[model samples]
Target: MRTAVELSWRLLRGGGRRSMVGSLLTLAAVAVSTGLLLFAVGANHAFLQRAHADAWRHPGDSVANPTAIEALSTDYVQGEPVTIIDLAALNGDAPVPPGMSRFPEPGEVWTSPALAHLMKDLPADQLAKRFPSPSGTLGRDALVHPGELVAVIGRTAGDPATTARRDVVEHLGATGGPSRIDRFETDASWSADVYLLLAGLASVLMVVPLLVFGGAAARLTVARRDSRLAALRLVGATPGQVVAITTAEAVLTAAAGALAGLVLYAASVPLLTHITIAGGGWFAGDLWPGPPLLAGVLAAVPLLVGASAVIGLRRVVVSPLGVARRETPPGMRAVRILALAAVVIAFGVAGGGLIDMGRAGMIVLMVFLVLAFLAINFAGPWVVALIGRLTAATARRPARLLAGRRLVDDPRSAWRTVAGVALTGFVAGFLALLNAGPSSGGPPDELRVAVPYERSAAVAGQAEKRLAGIDANVSVKRTETRDDPLDADGPVTTTGVVTVTAPGGTAAVDRARTALTGLVPGKVVTTGADEDVTGDRLLADLRTGALTVLVVSFLIAITSAGITSASAVLDRRQAYAMLRLAGTPLSVLDRARRQETLIPLVVMGGGSLLTGLFFGLPFAQGFGFSGLIGLAAFVVLGFGGILGAGALSRPLLRSVTADPAPRPD
Candidate 1:
């Protein structure tokens, strides 16, 4: 056992550049996978924490109305009733006062501190005249006024009882404006944010399977080293001992990978933070760092290492016969189906959630994702047949015949490669879809009318009138911004615009431009204060998230696929030699190799891609699937690239074949 372990170590450490290359590739996969998972999980946690803080503190100090009035500037007549929250909602165990509405109306109240500052500009006796006192104060005075920025309620301004709602007040600061006359009491759902954290982690964790299982291809090197392992077996090495030694090597390799991954993860975090912080539209809160986050990092190491070791041992056996002959894993079809089934269950769960919740956009996205994944695996035969027929139609003569024959020659390998290419395609397609979808709702068309903000009632009205003048068929969709806050520079105002139906030829309406007209001086500005911007950083994380997964997993797959296919070809060297001696052309033999590899490559790649899309759909829809057609186009291109790679045959028998000329013995 000691001897075998020593031999394994020596071989691992001493082998030339090829050995080093293989080891590095293995290490790279582990590092990338681990690092990605860590970054994604960490960033998600950090982002969520920041989101909560930002929403509670500075900007979320006021209320936004999505439906009733778009902006306070538009709603504020020269004289109208106003409400200001005197103090923020207090958390206490003591009994509360009654008769005061649990929430307050916008422009109907003011905080004493805020009023004191504003009253700095007015005489003390005149302060009460300009701003009347409200009925109740949690502990302080509520000042009622007309069209003035006063007490900021941190809850929705539409609610009547939030005399001091924290959410309304924070929103008031965010919008850069005065508090409004009407704000609704509402809570933002954080489900999507939670899902982002979990989903991003899962996405990163998926790399584990690819790295562990994919590295199984390297076990072919063990086959080459069979005589060495057998020699140890002959000497006092037990089967268990041999297995232990091999597994230990796998452990060492994976450990190195995990460590590297951790280092990469830790090192990159600050940089990621910098980028996110600099962008700073909304996520301007302190980073999340605590025991839970540290625990998450620690947990990933053993999980990755143990998984890798298990996969390595699955490649070789404890017995001496393990190294004697090449053995393909058993019941591939059932295994593939089982794997597919698990993915299907995941998709069903996600889709079912979306459906039950009546989230139409999410449901639609998930449905397409499910279809894209299933298309790669179950549709392999059909895909081959279709491609074969298509290629046959373009065949000049012999090339066409060869292309058609490839469908039957090694369909599985061909499809695996195709599946891989398709995964990349699906992501691209999904992005394209997003671009095409409505910026806010339904879909964009000529005369698309939308309320940019729910509270911007005055602006919405003005925009509607402008659109009405253009054409009657113009659409006007009003959305509530009761939860959105105005900027600090302006009065709390809701801003939404109506889409005008041009006479078949006109420019699309600029939402920001329309918002500019109704703002109070030094106050409301267009564009900048939407919930979407608050969530933008999370989406940016996705851009690299997908690429990281793709690159690492694809590399693992490629390495594993190449090694396994090469070894399989080597085991069949005698067969190839005999065929060459016979009348079979070298080209046919080469074609056969390509067929064998291409099938599985297509299958695995395509199936994984389809699975990704299926799982990704509900999430995509939640985000809004707008550029679906573009996503499809990207998928098609990815498929073509994979197919092309699979079809190109390597110089077969170059190393395997012996020279015809005799060598001196």
Candidate 2:
């Protein structure tokens, strides 16, 4: 073992420029994979933390001998959601909330830092007047994210704001009315759950591609490594010694790369904090994956690299003579294609609602989607080989002929070059078709407030009186239901909606809402535009997350293409040298390399994109103009990115083919 380790170190350090370049490429690949994996894991953790931070607003359970009463309402200021928590203590023993040092006194208000800033910027009547001057700021533990706007107002036990008569149930078990509670913690809201699901989905999308890229790192310069290892076997080195040497080399390199990846993740934290999700940007600590997770990833990456390296050694280990003679391995089997087809069909059935899987149906569908995604990987090399055979059969140009033969020679290597973009194309297609279109809302200037059905006339009179100074001609009418998309319970049927329309513009709407703030007790005074705010925000968030996923995917795709293309040049250096000596032009060689990547890219990328669209069809209501535009844009960008990555390796190809001297291995 000691001798094997020493031999491995000597081989790694003493290998010439080509070997050094190969090692660097592998290190870079592992580093990128490790950093991205950490980011994906961190993002999931951040969403959960955000959910936990805001869970207190949900009010866990109602106690018979409660110490406090809590009422939750939402307010809109400049088109942003501001969660308002109205609280009153029934006894001195009432527990303080997450961010507060002690229970607030009556008339005291606590605001998040974001809300404090917004209050200072807006007019007193427009926003600040809605609450008394903030007496304290809510801490991070009490806020979902750094930019979230939340206000906790302390009220007297009998205050109308906390004791309003709510006829509708907001969530499943709790009425919209204030609830008695002995504690502040509870399960996350439905919105939090939605965010968590999206975050998890995004992680799955990213981590898989990163894993593929990481595995490809082990195969970089495989031709050179195999020849070297084969020579060791022929020199009477046992298979165990050969495995020890390979493991030692791969583990050391992967460990260094993993550490470098941690550094990269740390450096990216400041930039990641700027991305807004769930109505606010992240806190620095929110993006931290913690010490245990970080350690696990560090260990996992090197082990994965080591395992991949060993797995690729079968040919050299089984028959060193065959490797030395440069025999081509058997072609990939059709079973790879079968596995992919099976997964796709299963996904379609599960997602299309063909089977009644109950509440776990969505979970089952997501699992199939992931399987289909991984299956694309399994099928890619076979598709490449098939494309190669056709190209070799029909190619008219030397470049095309060379490209075909290369693909047939090693389909796995060809597949790795375009796998990242192929997966990215799938993500782009899935997200594009899932976009929600613009929602039609009520008249922009109207302010709608839900009031008790019995007191409709009295509330209308009070509303008119409150807005008398703002607009005397303000029309007020009572309706049967509240049309608020943000309301989790859907349209409130039991309550009466008091529609208030003023002659003036948005200013009048804001003033009307302010005037009717507590006129209907616990109910929120929302505008006609507010009817679509929830849907609009959800759509906007979806687009943002989709854009984020596309960007990250493209980065990985481009990086994988560029790195693997360069490594491929290193792997085939001797072949290129011999071809050049035989009078083949460098231009032909470069063109062949580009065609090798482009052919499979066109075939596999299109397949994955179509599969993504197929999976998304069940959820898509219709193809929106924006979705079409996004699809077209990504298609153009994906092809353009692959071309650019291919172009980057042109110089490497030229350099490798610069010398045509025959050298002994």
Candidate 3:
């Protein structure tokens, strides 16, 4: 145990700055991923809570009137007459109460504080209006008359059988006061949905990279120490001890990193609350790293490292020293079959769930990716053989022949580089395309329109007449909407968007809208693309948020791919040296790496494409995104993979050529 501890400390310090940097870099990646996941999760939880609260605070659920404001009466007095005031007159033509004054103007309506707040700008005092009665109207069905001075109150839901809470009524002013309105509820879902989506995506994104990078680290660290381990074996150390020593060291380091991360995550949760994007609300609570989550983190760290060490050690244990000198290649056939199965299952589940498409397409896509990866991994020799044959004609072509032969000779080494490059190139290009796309040039136009959703036909006609009068040459599009009583405490409006082109810039469109709005102030509200609150814009924002998550995951995957490929190639220095001695040139070596790595790169890229297609095609039926967006993603993925491979190759080549590197005879 002491020896193992001593050895671990020695190894930990051996890499000096490189090891520290590597560990720190790994930690940073993990920390960022974990932190984001926690923040997103917390934000989501808080948002959902607030949504439920807001829903409870409104009273439209039980009320028969769905609208924020209900107009009770609009009666005419004797020819040039005015509305009279009477509490009972709400039901009929009752005379005004003995002493109260009646409003004598048109467009006057009585309303509660909430409703009045929304219409503060309206001349309610001069126009007849009723406020909620002071005692509350819970069971009464009576309405208010012109001069009746009835009160209107805000209602909040409580226990089913109990009296619901009501707020004091107030008259309308130019800047209305607060009343619980139902319209706010419409966009409330977004408050919670954003956090939930972010949290879920962040969690998923972290998992893959942790697995890939952790596995690579363990594999590289253990393999690099095998010579020392073998010497310990000669000194009579048992295999169990070898396993224990190596595994213990790894677990210790991993635990240290995990603890560091946990501490950092806990510390930063407060700051994270304010870090919101896309209208995603703040994180509202302390991060609770409960037993299960903490256990997962602690367990995952050690398990990842330990598993890699065990896998590597098992091979060493099974092989005799003489035979060990000649490393046995991993079987290509086995890996291909396994990877195929994995790819199929994952894609099948994901694709089916995403598109309401049966699980079969998803299954096939997943299976293909897994199979493709396995084939590259296990059937390295077979792939090399195929590539070798394909380029066999170039055997006499010097660099080309050398590249082909080298790839065929040891496909595993060759393909790792390929995978790295492909990942880098694809990511880089995908980002470029996003920036290059016209849609990404600026924020999407904000859609705004006026109210009267049901009366849109009449409203649109009025708008068109007004527009024509102003020489706007505009077209009016009618739309339907459910009122959001909360937004303005009245009937709100919704509409499908309309495009307007009036021989001038957007400014001209605005001017035209202003001219029309001036003509018909209350009868017609804009319900098309000219309104301030367009549902489509919100929907688009949500879609953009989802896309952002996908892009971030892709980037994390690229970084992970680089680490895995570099570590894998670096661990097999002896094998590469042997290949070099056998006269493999740099070009052939690079080709083999590209082939192996590209298999997975292409598979993942294809999988992403299919995933997008599943969503985009159906969505396009309603709203379209350009096909070039997806195509660009694929191209970027390919280039990223290539670049990553090339970058990792330098250290790989150096490692391969370093001597006295052990020779695999």
For TM-score, the strongest prediction is 2
Q: For candidate 2, what's the RMSD?
A: 3.3
What digit string (tens of lDDT, one per residue) describes model 1 on residues 411-499?
A: 44344334334444434433431221223422222323234455345554555564443332433455445443654544444545554
Best by lDDT: 2
Clash count, predicted structure 1: 133
lDDT of model 2 at residue 309?
Answer: 95
Worst 10 residues of 3 by lDDT: 72-81
Off by over 4 Å in 2: 165-177, 354-359, 452-454, 480-496
- C-alpha positional error of residue 528 in candidate 1 after TM-score superposition, expressed in Å: 11
Model 2 lDDT per residue over 293-395, tens place: 8899999999999999999999999999999888999888899999998987776656778236533665666676678778998899999999999999999
Model 2 earns a TM-score of 0.94
Per model, state how many residue pairs clash. 133, 0, 78
Evaluate all candidate structures by whole-model CA lDDT and list the values in order. 0.42, 0.83, 0.42
TM-score of 3: 0.54
